[model samples]
Every structure is written in structure tokens, then in C-alpha cells.
Target: MIRYINIKNIFIIYLVALIIMVVLKGDLSDVLARMESIIEQRNEGNWNISLKPFESISSVLDSYNRFGVNIVTVKVAILNIIGFLPMGFLLPLLKKNNTSFIKTMLKCLVFILIIEIIQFIACIGVADVDDVILNLSGCIIGYIFYLIVRPVIKS
Candidate 1:
């Protein structure tokens, strides 16, 4: 079977997806306001540091232990994990033989780190460390999906 996708198309689609993610994460007005606050905070040397490495995950588990996985906790888990799945699918499609998994993962790590840092600085979101972990987990999940679908798509 012949697939219609090429590296250029995948790259363009991936870039668009990433831009969508950014816009969804913070709309322009909110982001600009947050950026102003961030500048003020930086000038005052007063930072908003709220990095919960495992707190949210543990909260979800604890809630599950008590209530057997409610919708709120489920959404938390699912959203974080499913968010960056496209990254996993797009990279391998972008370059087959030349792409290294470790390199790709590291690139994602750095990108996530940068996003988190900006979010934290701008006070746009919680900037949880757990999001990085969860998004990376999502990427791995996406890669697994890619592996499963690649052959089928190729055939």
C-alpha cells in the first residue's frame, strides 16, 4: 500500500500541532498578562515556585484508593499522558534511519522543560514537574502506538 505522507508533510503537521498545544495551554491575552507579571516578578526577584514532582500523581492514586478512580483523577491522568502523543508518532515518521530514540526523547525532555519553565515563570499554569514526567510517559505511549501502526500503515 502506498501512504500519502512524506517527511515534509509530517513536519508541517507536527509543527501545527505543537502550535495548537501552545495556544490551548495559554491564550494570547492570558499569556501576555502572565508575561507582564513574570517580568514584574523577575524584576522584584519574587518567583512563584510550585513544582510538584509526584504530588499530583499521588493525589490521584490516593483518591482512587478512596473512591476507586473518579472522573477528575482519571482526566488528570489521561490528559497529561495523551497530550504529547503526537511527538512520538511524528519524529519517527519525519526521519526513519537517522532518528535515534534516545536523542528524540532527550529533545522532548528539553522542550518540555522549557515549556514548564516558561509556564512557571509566567504563572500561566501550575508548572508541575509531574507534567514533564507524564508528558514523557505520553510520548512513550505514542511511540508504542507508532510502532504498532507503522507496519500496518506501510502495508
Candidate 2:
């Protein structure tokens, strides 16, 4: 129905906007300038990609133990999880085949992997396996949420 489509479109827009925010998390006014800077960094070999899952987390823990400063790490971890939670739930709703749990999760992992790779190559952000873990966890949480809410909405 038209009504369903309108709502679905609105949700799609919101999901896309949220994903952009989750990835960029920065000023958009000078996107070209920012991208140029990133490109420059890439050329200059300012490359930073991390495969170690707990390296940042360990440093954060160390910082917390030494200086009682955790705002940066804690906030980032929480935000990463929170940001992807909606993706988990929304993807299932948006994709017909994604209703299956394992299929949806595998798809989410692939999607997140691609995003992380782009961030690394583009110099937009650090590529971290820890983030993948946390983001995947968030998506699973979202799937749980969808499972809880779907029946209620249908009935």
C-alpha cells in the first residue's frame, strides 16, 4: 500500500542518514576539503589500520587505571555499538531475505567489513577489528529487538 511505502521510504532515509553519521561523525560543510585532506594523508602514508582487537581497549584500560580518563574510548565503544543496533533491526525489515537470523548477521558482517575497509583506505578513520566485534554485537542486539517488536506490530 502507499502508506506502507511512505513509511518504509522514511525509515530507509533515516537509516541511511544514521549510517553516514556513524561512519563520518564529522563536519559536512567542507566535505571536499576534508576529503582532500584525507587523500593527502593517504598519499603521505599516514596509514593506520589495526587488526588487533584489544589494543585500543587495552590502552584505554591502561589510561583509566593511570589517569582515570576514559571518555574517548568509552564513548567511542558505546557509540559504535549504539550506531549499528538500528542497522541490525532495520536491515531485516528492509530486506526480504534478511529475515533469516544467520543470513542477516552474515550480511551485516560483510557490510561492516566493507565500511571498515573504506574507512581505512580513505583515511577517514581507523580500521579496527574491535569495532567490528562491537558493531556486530550491536547488530545482534538490534535483531533481538526486532524479534521482540515484530510480533507485537503484526498482531
Candidate 3:
């Protein structure tokens, strides 16, 4: 079993386990409730886009004239970043040695899409088209990072 424990294989296992946990721990009704609550809060004009000192530095930390992007865009970008962080860096590890990069990326995309499907079914979050785009971008970025760092890791 120790022989089977490699960085690539481990990432795949971790991703699968995470999906299982998300499914087992979250329910459709709970997700639906959370989404509805978010909508209600937005409609009430209480969804302030305030910026914090450390958190919104790019936005100049201003509450009124903050970053140009809207709340929804930020949220989707965050979600995408979260979902793709691993894919960008660790995803290549999942493929056997000598596997094509495109194939590895495709596999990672499929896996992320599955997670999106689960999120949609559970209603824990909205299944916006933007999320898919964001998540893919994240994965691609992660992959690029991985390629750049691959040589360093081998040495």
C-alpha cells in the first residue's frame, strides 16, 4: 500500500473523497435554504460591498468606490479559484507518467464538472454558467503553474 501512495494518485483520492463528503454531509433542502437566504439578503439592500484593509487591497480598500467588479463576479471568481486550485497544480499528477497534458486537463475538467453537478443537485449553490468558466480558468492556471514548477520538483 505504501508503494501506491504517490502525489498524483493521492490528489485524485483526495478529490474523490471530498466529493463524497460534500454529498453525504450536505442535503438539497439545506442548500436550497442557503440560496434562498442569500437572495433575500440581496433583495433587502443589505448586501454591502464593503472592502477590508487586507482583503480588498486591489480595490484600494474603499467601501464606496471599491473595485470595479460586482459582488456576483467576485463570488464566482472565488468559487472558480477554489475549485481549480488543485487542478492547476496537482491535477497533472493524476495521470500516469507520459500521459498527454491535454488528456490530464480533460480528466480534471470532467471531475470538476461532476462537482458542479453535485452542487447544482444539492442546491447548496447556484449552478451559474459563469462558474464553469471560472472553474475551468482556475484549472488552466493551476496547470500552468504546475508546468512551470515541474522541473523544480523533479530536481
Candidate 4:
């Protein structure tokens, strides 16, 4: 028989693969633990900072005691950025060709919010408002990149 591949079906496979990777990496537990530790830090009065850029975004960890963005917030935001940006990349493949960028961004934001809620209830991590914002920023950045790169690739 001739080979046939539906792009949507391939995207579903990719999503399943991503979910499996997340589960196998024990990332869920790690995320939970990180959140819990952050909440504990907050309770201990360890949540305050100043506005200064360190070597990397995480370099602020060296001076967390004096910085506004604590380690947990940074970590969670970074995770959201990493996780959701790739997830957004898949949307253009799975979604209708005419889907608007704004709608895609909103869908990514909603997905991040669900993850944030799960993180809060998992008892391993702190549910943070800032994490959602940063994560959405990352998704928007990824979507914009897609917009810029698509025309080039199609040429």
C-alpha cells in the first residue's frame, strides 16, 4: 500500500511523546517539590529582591537574599518558558492554517494556567501569578518567532 501521513495525526503522536517525556523525567514531582520549597521560603520571609541582571536570568540565585525574583519564581517561570514554547510550536502544525496568532497565544496562555493550577494543588510547588505572566510572554515570543520564520520556510 502507498504510504500516507496526516499531519494532524503526526502532531498527536508528537504530543503523546512529549507527555511521556515529561512523565518519565519525573518533572511533575520535581515541579511539585520546587513549588513547595518556594512556598516555604515565602513563609520564612525569604521573598524580596532588587532589580539587577545577573550573568544569566538564574544568576540572580547567587544573591537571592537581596533580589526580588526568588529562585522558585525564576525556576517556575523558566520551566514554563521551556515547556510551553515548544508546545506552541506544535500548534501551527495541528491547528487550521488560518488560525490567528492572537488566538494561538491565548490558547497557550490557557494551557499554562492549567499547568500552574495543577502545580499549586500538587503540594510540591508554589502557585505563582508571575509565573503565568512570564510563561505567556515566552509563548508569545515563540509564536512571533513562528510568524517570522514561516514565510521564510515556505519560500
Model 2 segments beyond 4 Å from truth? 2-7, 28-46, 95-98
In model 1, the clashing pairs are: none
Candidate 4 per-residue lDDT, tens place, 1-155, comes to 11124656665675576445432336666665666676787689864222233233445455565766586756644765675565566566455465587778778778766755655454344345655666676777767777777777457
Number of the candidate with higher lDDT, 1 or 4:
1
lDDT by residue for model 2 (1-155), tens: 66467648866786678668756777775555666777777689765578988787687788889989678888988887898887788777765554888988998899889889977776677788888988899999999999999887557
Two-way TM-score contest, 2 vs 4, winner: 2
lDDT of 1 by residue, 1-155 (tens): 12336656766776577646653455778677876776687679866554768888888889899989699778867877777788876676666664566877887788778877767755665577778889899888777887889888667
TM-score of each: 0.71, 0.78, 0.58, 0.56
What C-alpha lDDT do the candidate models reach, one value each? Answer: 0.73, 0.79, 0.60, 0.59
For every candidate, C-alpha RMSD to the true structure in Å: 3.9, 3.0, 8.0, 6.9
Per-residue lDDT of candidate 3, residues 1-155 (tens digit): 34236775767676776565443435766656776765676679644232232344343225336556577646635755675667667756544374356876687678766766765554444444444555677778778877888788667
Off by over 4 Å in 4: 1-77
Top TM-score model: 2
Tell me model 4's lDDT, rounded to 2 decimals.
0.59
